[model samples]
Target chain A: MEQPVVTTKDALLHAAGALFAVHGIEGTSIRAIAKESGANIAAVNYHFGSKENLYLAVIRHVLEKTRCHRSEELLKHRRDWEGKPLLCSEAVYRIVEEYIQQFFTGIHPRWYGRIFMRIFLQPTPILWEIINELVMPNFDSLREVLQCCRPGMGKEEADLWLDSFIGELMHYVFAEDFLLIIPGHRKLSDAGYQKDILRHVAKMLIRGLELPVPVFLQEDIVHA
Target chain B: MEQPVVTTKDALLHAAGALFAVHGIEGTSIRAIAKESGANIAAVNYHFGSKENLYLAVIRHVLEKTRCHRSEELLKHRRDWEGKPLLCSEAVYRIVEEYIQQFFTGIHPRWYGRIFMRIFLQPTPILWEIINELVMPNFDSLREVLQCCRPGMGKEEADLWLDSFIGELMHYVFAEDFLLIIPGHRKLSDAGYQKDILRHVAKMLIRGLELPVPVFLQEDIVHA
Candidate 1:
């Protein structure tokens, strides 16, 4: 596993990210971030120019760090399938599986997800920029894959299915604690439990979309 | 439409709930709550005893107000099916549909959902009380309905299915803003759009759980 490199800038970003997640940007002060990071207040100004700029940097850092793995997987899938006949249903399953895996594995140290959750719950001016620049491209690519799976599907229907699919996966991210209270529930960190979720959500998406289940997934479709 | 009655106590609860949702408990003060409610600061002490108790009261208010309809619907389902041969699949569908309807209609003025979201994202001691006292009973009841729909299902498997089912619906509540950004997407408050989502999620749960499709829902199961 590659460890994240820690420089003054990285330390500042990490500290600021944690603070911002706990308290909104307006509530978090540069002095607290600096103190937490073991860097001086002057360092924040010198590096990010202003508190708002520091916040923007923190958001960008979070997005880049958390999304890097999923983006790479998406690119690899596209590259591998180039000029080949695509198994649309299999591709869709792979995408959903990979997304769930990335969500659990990629969002490390936990605070990274909290930052996004805070932003989602309490929108800031920067949210629009993040949506347009970062979120939409990823959403559009996923939609394209879904469109391939269900030919002639209108954009409106595709969007609804996409929302439902992503919504299920994102719920685990958002409400992991709440779900843990169920009797016989295992921690999401349990590898076996993670595998169960990955399979469960991917299967849900495939069936919900009415895609023909690939032969590999048919074995797991047995009713409880 | 029945309007929420606004006594001074109700006014205080409403104002405090919104502030707590936005700023969280530690960040919000009784003085601010009193000012927002147009009541004197001493009124907070007199009515709720202290800020912590007031916070507790606000949470109770939100939960009671938001969940009252769903509880009634669940009771109605139980009462209607008493001493009758229950179609388990139909019962499960009705529970899911009524839950979704309650989510949209009962969580009115919006801040109620936000208060829960905030608590979910940033848990305090009250989360345990909420989960054990309020959340678990509702969860257990739903799981019972689900087990009826799938006989011989183990507790663990039933829990997984219940989590996935509720996760999909809760996602719409958590990510309403993100979903709205999709092109051609209608506001969730739009009755037509709400109907589409209610149908989409109900169908997804029915199919994902591999429940026997109730004849009433078969018409909407065609692939796009």
Candidate 2:
């Protein structure tokens, strides 16, 4: 029997993603990646053709994996909801709860957050490409769910609400270090804290969607 | 007349802040700082004593500056609210609005966001120090405002709401690049968009605070 072998492409992508996360694209060297992956410079060249291509491939791989995981989560919730349609607030809670679970699961590879943060903070042309191909379609699908829950909601208002919802979760997922550092404070590290955050945020977002327009925001919303 | 001179300490800090933002603390070197600042290596050693010390000093300087600016804003709002004590929802709106203004002001030094992002996402012992000395006090003060707004709100609940509020602002301030890249969607770069976001989040958070507790979260609140 022959031993299993990892493909050169996968090896290069794994090594590149980790290195890129730490050193960034400009700071990382092809020679270093080749050495780290236990592949020769020739193999790296043959597989990726160039450093830029390798970086893009790594992003694509991560995006695809993330999409699959998230889509499954979304679809599962939708399927459950279909059996007995959830009230608007209940649906909102469930959706946000799933997001919190996914965010805090720590299942992603170590370098995934770094790579995601880099692109999010300092976007380039490649970011536009990724958002168009990977992010927006999924976003639209989620937006539809939220909109269905509140038929009276306008699209712009709904979009803004969704952005806020996702934004809050992003901070928890990406900036937990900042949140956790405050001494003597309640840490999100406590058991069930993530669930609490989910409950709080979902209630807030759903209420926000349903609340009568405050007079101050009326002018702003009109223009918006 | 004698020409005014920039001190070696100021030069080193400015250079180090920029370099650290791009390459992170470990990746930057004293040699690079010296060269960039036009100060000799001996001057760098004499002023900061070590690279780590200099890094800590830079964080302290930034935190102090940011704290001062934010404190002024909060104080101004409080004074105005004193003359006409704002309603809970109105106060929430104003506080959030001020935050959005500060976040998008672009008045902070160029490297501020990058350096802040690095320390925030990837923590070091220095992060703990910075959070203790600079972050927690300001956070506690803001938490008080939120607590005052909703008299019935518990400490845990207020803290959760505050986190969600700040988290939404962080996305706008830090992740604007990602926001702007979505094709055919409204970009934060559009005029008055930040204002709209401030309004949206303030409304959502206020409404969420006032909304009746969902059944699932009721148990968590009791335990909380």
Candidate 3:
């Protein structure tokens, strides 16, 4: 089958995202992006108005693409759980599992992660917008889920635990290459290894929070 | 007393480290380093031979400086523990605490961390050498300490757990800036906050590994 034609705007964003991932914002030039995308400099200006706008567009494009996929999966999950009552612990496990799988496996072209790491290391002005608009709602949902798991858990304490949980997962995401150097470490690309990580993280969170284990995870806890 | 004079090579390494942290390896130029360090381009060539060599020298300088301080602290801890049977749990706690503090606070000028992060994200050919020479020794020590904590734990399991532990700590180190945007988050620079993080990490690891809590940490576990 013939491939659909890629618009100049999409091509520019893709090219800019890859270059920015490697050289960073200030390091990457409009001319380089234009050349990489096979578009003229004037075309870049016409499409995105400026390099900064183009950078923001690239970030938005990646985030929106991921967010759309996540929303669909989450919608499916909600539909599946509609008639069945999920224990809070089970709910948290599923949430974390879905998050890990989607984050590590669902994102594509690799540059998406690099772009995120670049912005994470050196945040731009749009960071506040991205956090509030795209990140905060998900964080709020996770926080609410944790509170449901352990009633009377103080907001501050719950937030800290959530941070620890996220720190563990983000570390693996960001440092996969570094982690692989350790003896006997498995590839994140391995589906079984991903499940192992999910169980490992869930075990740590459930135990650390002193929450009652769901029946599904009880066996793993014993062996762990 | 008059301030000590900085040598030409030291100046170049310092400048290169800072610039590389901002612009990355390929993005930075030798002329920029020379200008920033107030040395001529010829002087840079005379001192470090090449930009790549200068970059490696910067890495070596930062690692050695931190290692020296770490060695001193470890020596002091050993001396203090002499003739007293230290619990494996306590040893692990102390090692992790020292690591977090040294990694986050002991390194000076801030640019050191930025340089490390840059290298971490965009690894150079020297990464393997660094893994073997600097990182592996510390990792080995942690692994041994963990094994002492939990006898009969498989090497692969122990390694996975160690990665999770390191992942938690590293996430805090790497994502400190992004994390601060979260509501109710504390500054990493705060000494008290660092202790809270240390305790939080220890609690998670101890529970996750099912290790017996040392007498000193028993109270915290109860409250936790």
- i-RMS, every candidate? 2.5, 5.8, 2.5
> How would the docking of model 1 be graded?
medium
Model 2 chain B: which ten-residue window has the lowest total lDDT? B215-224
Would you list the clashing residue pairs of candidate 3? Answer: none
Each prediction's RMSD to truth: 4.2, 9.5, 5.2
Reference-based lDDT, each prediction: 0.70, 0.66, 0.69
- Candidate 2 regions exceeding 4 Å error are A1-54, A68-86, A144-156, A184-191, A211-224, B1-57, B68-86, B150-156, B184-191, B211-224
Work out how many backbone clashes candidate 2 has: 0
Candidate 1, residue B42: lDDT? 91
| Per-residue C-alpha lDDT of model 3 across residues B1-224, encoded as one tens digit per residue | 11343988777888888888766766689999989999998887798888888878887776665552332344445545433334445665776677676666644666666676775676655667875687677776666556656666677667768777777777776776776777766677766667767777877787777766666765542222
Q: Which candidate achieves the best DockQ against the true structure?
A: 1
lDDT of candidate 1 over A129-164, digit per residue (tens) = 876676677777777666656667777667778787
Tens digit of per-residue lDDT, candidate 1, span B63-112 = 76656234335545664653332355566566666766666764477667
Measured with C-alpha atoms, the lDDT of residue A116 in candidate 3 is 64
What fraction of the true interface does each of the listed models get right, in terms of native contacts kept? 0.57, 0.71, 0.54
Task: Write down the RMSD of candidate 1 (Cα, Å).
Answer: 4.2
Q: Which of 2 and 3 is ahead in TM-score?
A: 3
DockQ of 2: 0.35
